[model samples]
Target chain A: MAEKTLSEVNERIRDGSVRVVTAEEMPSIVDELGPAGAVREVDVVTTGTFGAMCSSGLFLNLGHSDPPIKIGRAWLNKVEAYGGVAAVDLFLGATQPSIDRGIEYGGAHVMEDLVSGKAIEVEAEGVGTDCYPQLGLETTLRLEDFNQATMVNPRNAYQRYNAATNSSQRTIHTYMGTLLPRMGNVHYSGAGVLNPISNDPSFQYIGMGVRIFLAGSQGYIIGSGTQHNPQAGFATLMVTGDLKQMDRRFLRAATFTRYGSSLYLGIGVPIPILNERLALSTAVRDRDIEVPVVDYGVPRRDRPSMAKVNYEQLKSGMVRIGRQEVATSSLSSLLMAREVAATLKGSIEKGEFVLTQPVAPLSLAGSARPMKQTKEFPYVEDVMSREVVSVTEDISVAEAAQAIIKSKFDHLPVVNSAGVLCGIITTWDISKAVADGTISQVSQIMTRNVFSTTPDQPIELAARTLDTHSISALPVVDQDGRVIGMLSSNHLSRLFAGRRPR
Target chain B: MKLLLRVAPGIVRKPLIASVILETGALVNIERASIDAVSGEIVLDVSQEKCRQVKDALERLGVDVILLEIPVIRDDSECVHCGACVAICPTGTFHFEDWRVVGEPGRCVQCGACVTACPHRALRLVLK
Candidate 1:
């Protein structure tokens, strides 16, 4: 059987004679007609994936203001956007957290809000210059107000990804979702056989300048993604497209609670059935793709791998690990993937969508390296909570209790008139005072022999002391023994939980 | 029908499940029980007709009864069948059958633990 040429496929698509099928549909078609016959009959195979792509962001020229400020610092709805581009140009990263609300609101939210026709507050600051004299400006702007807006993502469409599970005794929060303790849940991210790059494993027709269905609009592949590693079992691509043509339905802003904000990208790639090889690759199924089941409980990227399981076993919902059969779940949305493929198929059948040849093929070589550790040791002053809420020794028992409750602190540092660390009062002490009806001053019930830490001391020492003494918080004092800040177990846990060993 | 009962610390010594079975004459399958000297919780499957009688009897015994509904498996076509829900479920409501995830609705406690544990957001708890 002769393979179809790219031009022939395009002509067939234009004339509404080409048969279009999705990656999900190709398997049965191949089974029915065999490889050679299927390659001869099918003209295109559409693939897609809807997963969190953190390396995604939008570049927009906010037009020009009345005074025309060269935005050195910019923010959209309190989420900081990169202002280092041109005078009015800004790049809002998908994972950039909201300044006020942290991970809950971010650049992805801003993009979704803009696409939904919601007006967003655009605040920018810059040094006044001769050409652009405005120092600061605050105004609401919509997506329509932008001179040019495009989604320029450094990475999207991962070919495949590992399944994550926790082996440790404690639950871990990750971008992959929450992993319960002792192999509680395994979370995998990828549409497997339906993924675009997975369907085109060798990057045959997928290259720079290839037309793609991006967020419901016609888009193109830009280049290899930031960490493109074809040798590492999967391919990654960098893509770009006009943001104006995109819809709010295809763009969603998601907050992974403690893990932070991410953008759910809907990308569809159409492959021209150019050859028998290409047709066979597109017929790949979940049973054929394999990924490692990695333990996220280990704090490093080189975490222990319990087993390498295929998507069939993963989709089967259970895999054997040693003597136990562990459950699995996927983070990628197969529903969206199928929808994209179906939509692409409909467009091709209607002779509305056309395929594009690559301007340049992606590089097949290159590897990504892990981040190196720093040599510097951090100090207590660097990590301590500077916004100290201390109670004076003269405050009444009721007042002390109220302060502890309002601040949500189990222990409150007691200070004196001379700006010195006097003592520390705890909730237990306040409860004791309330029980005895000794509603006098905090100094009467406060613990005087308080162990304090110094600003210049290593943070590890303070943490060790807190753990060793079973204390909740420690007051950080300066050289003059003046209370400067407070360090708590909660603060330390948050810092160390996600941190790699230096 | 299955129900999860939270026995208060004061009624920890009482045979709440036994009393309910006797009062309702309902056949009970204690799928899982985590009772201690202080307090306890149990997941029990009983006859559908006698479920109400069993619930009332447990309530009279000072036990907080929660009717368990089978968690609807959302979008099974999209399910990869990884058993993350099995690891977190206190009751063996989710298990592997020929490497596929099979939901035992009769044994489900409706704890909602599996719903949150499902990475695909497939399982959802609904009232019976």
Candidate 2:
């Protein structure tokens, strides 16, 4: 019997304490020899999902070696348990609900490592990856267990020498999977593409101190930072570039190697009371660290006590770090440049970057195109008279009544010769005049001493006036009391409705 | 940290062998893909080394399993567009492409998503 038959019989004996039957035996059992032709019924599948309640509060200025972000005991657990750069895979089940979460902003340069036609490639050995976007900056990265070893970029043909044949040949092909999270800003992309259709006109310019959030299910982030080469089994570290300019400032460069690579990771947040920020970089290698490089380095990177690498000195010539210049010979100056770049992009990364280039300040979205609103109060002007018609004091009852009927005007303004408005003749006034008949003119029946406003008066105040008087119109005039235009109840409603973009 | 893939008990492990039970009264329901419900009996097949591993893994993940002793049929053709194979496979591992079918073993819950996705009786899930 097949090995499968043996296992099936073992389970059968365990479950029913009966003799094992073979495929041939299934015939007699099904044809009436055994209990066979029976109805089978099953139920729906209940998929299981586990949820996590993660909380963390990190406070520190990352560059400061003197201090680090304040992570309380309770919050520390979050960093150790719930936090850390992680890869997320979402399986869209047949039935799922909508979710929106904040973005997970990360360092720039991610696209350089992505599978774009733009990624630069070269050939190397032992398999490693490095990127120094800027020229004279020094930066380091600390990562925990990645999905793979080495940082091989697929563009480089992976050729390992065959010892037996003594010749080099390609080994494997690479594939990319979803190893990083994705977010859509609607206005700016990591690639720095600005789409102008999604902004508010009132504040066409994105202002500073804007608290940015992303779209997705809670805990899902958008800033992308992971890349994997399945063909070579290597995962590349990605960085962020100005989504508008496509430039990276904070991180100068990165290097990935096999074996128990270098380690030292920290998060920084600023603190006002302490007048200092903190940095906590963990290390994988037991290397000696100097407390300060002030004598050799100054300016922005100068700190009384810092755990930093001197790229300028190192790059000037191979510096000796315990008889081993080779160990750290390849350090680049990009890290230092990255620090400067980060400072410049603080506003951009925070979504505070001005969309327009200047002169004609533009918005990231096109909704903010400039337009003009009426400046005159009795804005409702009669084309024939070249005169204002509103709700204040101006034309006589006979003239106003005649104007209303002739112009088919729903609103007539009362104003002074200086063009300032006093009151308005509305539909109600006309109704009363027609009802009283004894008036014979508009002033005799028109409502007087009604709500009026000046040119500088806020439109919101005009709305309140209409609401308070329970009136449908208000006449706007100048300081000289000259009739301007009529603020209609319908127009005010339309403005408020148009304020929100669909 | 080590991640031990745990299989569930109520889920099916042997979607490949469901074809052997074609004449049975029970029909493989496509929508009920997550759960493994057998009409009369469950059938399955796996290499000796992977048998217990696959079974235990599926069990830990909370998937159901059925044992069978039937052979599999592999005909690059004649596998009519049968939904039978898709119904049998709990894991939607098999994707119908323009040229032919592609199987991602790593993604295969081994529960058989494609088994039930098929419409014809071209495939089988034997115990061999």
Candidate 3:
């Protein structure tokens, strides 16, 4: 048997004699024909993955407006895009939240909408300059209106990732998706054997300038992705392409409630059957790929690990964690992955697509490390919820209840005429009073033994206090015992969730 | 022949399937059924000779009958076994066994909820 080359594969592809199959089909084919036979018969195998890619965004060069302002701020459907570049050029980060709506809408949705040909409201403010007189502009723009619309993602195609599960009593939302509490379900990302990087684990052929199928268009690997960890059993790549050539069908936006917005990217990579080694690599099975199962309940980057499980075990629907069988799910769409691979295969078979040798191969060494702490402690004021809505003790029970209902707050710090902390009233206290039929006065039902947190104190101390008491919220106060802000579990959860890498 | 039927609220209260079987004398192999107070749908396999009679009987009973080709699984090899389909599936078509996600197309009602709920977009409903 002779070794194959990319040029020969391209020649075969052009002549309609190429034997192409998807990554999903390679395993069985290799099993029947053996590695050498399979390599001899097949010319290429296409691999793909469609999942939540947060390190994705668009760089748009908007044509300059008449009397243009040197735009310093820009927004798309209320989601802010960085306008620090030129007056007409801006970069939109996929996870950048909406200023007004927060996580509900963001840059990802704006890009998806643009790809779908929906007009988006573009707002900008600029400092007036002689070259550009206009200081502010608000207008709708579509993908066709841009001078250049390009997707220049810094990192994508994670080689392998940890499967997430929650051990705490409360459900936690992360980029992994909603993790059900107490290990109710495990959520894993990546299409395993169907993933492109998983097939090219060593970055042998996949590197800078390698042709790829990006968002329904032909794109290229631009460089090594951020935090590229080749030795960590997975490969990552930075890819870019002309966004104008792509369609909405291949690009989508999705929101995971509290987890924020992410781009659903359709990517496919075609591997040239260069050798027997490449053929065997492409035939890697799901059972052979292993990823760690991490406990999402832990609030640290180096969170506690439960166990390492292979994709076969993870896909089995249930894995034994200790003595219990825990259910698992995947975030990456296997259906879309298959479709992408099949679509690429069709293109290759028709001689419309050809394999490319990378101009520059990817670096094999480098590892990502967590940010080191510079300060000993973080202040409570930094994390505390400053917008405190309090109630006066003189108010009636009905008034307090109405305040709680209208504000949608679980607890209200009660203040006296002197603006001093008098007591605290919670929905639980109100409910108990109502249940006991003593709902006449607010002071009678409010708990007087209120514990307060100081803004100057360490956040860890405040968190510890909240955990020790098992309280939902703590009123942050000054030395005078006047309520200044509120600290709650929701705030802590957001802080920790934000810390997790996308 | 296999058929998928959508029974309206008006016909849901009646013994429709039993009546159809009695009238046509055709064996009804119900693949799946999701019946609520408002509406109901069922997938069943019957003899080709009795398919036309079953459709006529169902229409007479005010049930919308659709001659359904089996729902095609576009890609089974890529399934990650996340069980998102198991939550919303009215039919016991999707299940988790041995820690992996499995789909029994024989029991599928072509509801399309699993296709929507699957985060990975791994399941697609192609009704021929």
Query: Model 3, B54: alpha-carbon shift in Å?
Result: 30
**Candidate 3 all-Cα RMSD:** 11.5
Error of 2 at A340 (Å): 33
lDDT by residue (B1-128, candidate 2, tens digit) is 01112224433354432432242323332222323353223233345544555555545445455432222333433232211232123344443343134444433333332332222223344431
lDDT of model 2, residue B128: 17
> Among these predicted structures, which one has the highest DockQ?
1
Q: Rank candidates by DockQ, best first.
A: 1, 3, 2
Given candidate 2, what's the lDDT at residue A56? 11
TM-score-best of 1 and 2:
1
True contacts kept of each: 0.19, 0.00, 0.07
Tell how far residue A10 is off in model 1, in angstroms: 1.5
Candidate 3 residue A468 Cα shift, in angstroms, is: 14
DockQ of each: 0.13, 0.01, 0.09
Q: Which regions of candidate 1 fall more than 4 Å away from where they truly are?
A: A31-34, A373-502, B1-128
What lDDT, from 0 to 1, does candidate 2 have? 0.27
Tens-place lDDT digits, model 2, residues A397-456: 566666777643477766555545545676667777667677655556655576666555
Q: Show the lowest summed lDDT stretch of 10 residues, model 3 chain A.
A: A493-502
The sequence of per-residue lDDT tens digits that candidate 3 reaches over residues A1-502 is: 6488888999998899999999988999888988898888888999988777899988988888888778899998999999999888999999999998887678888988887889989999987889988989999888999989899998888887888888977766677776767877777888888889888887778888999999888999998889888888756879998888886666777666566878888889999878878888899999999998899977656778898899888777678788778877777666677778888999999999899989988888866877778866567788777777899988888898888887635999999887788899999888887888856899899888887788887777678778867898889999898889888877778777764211
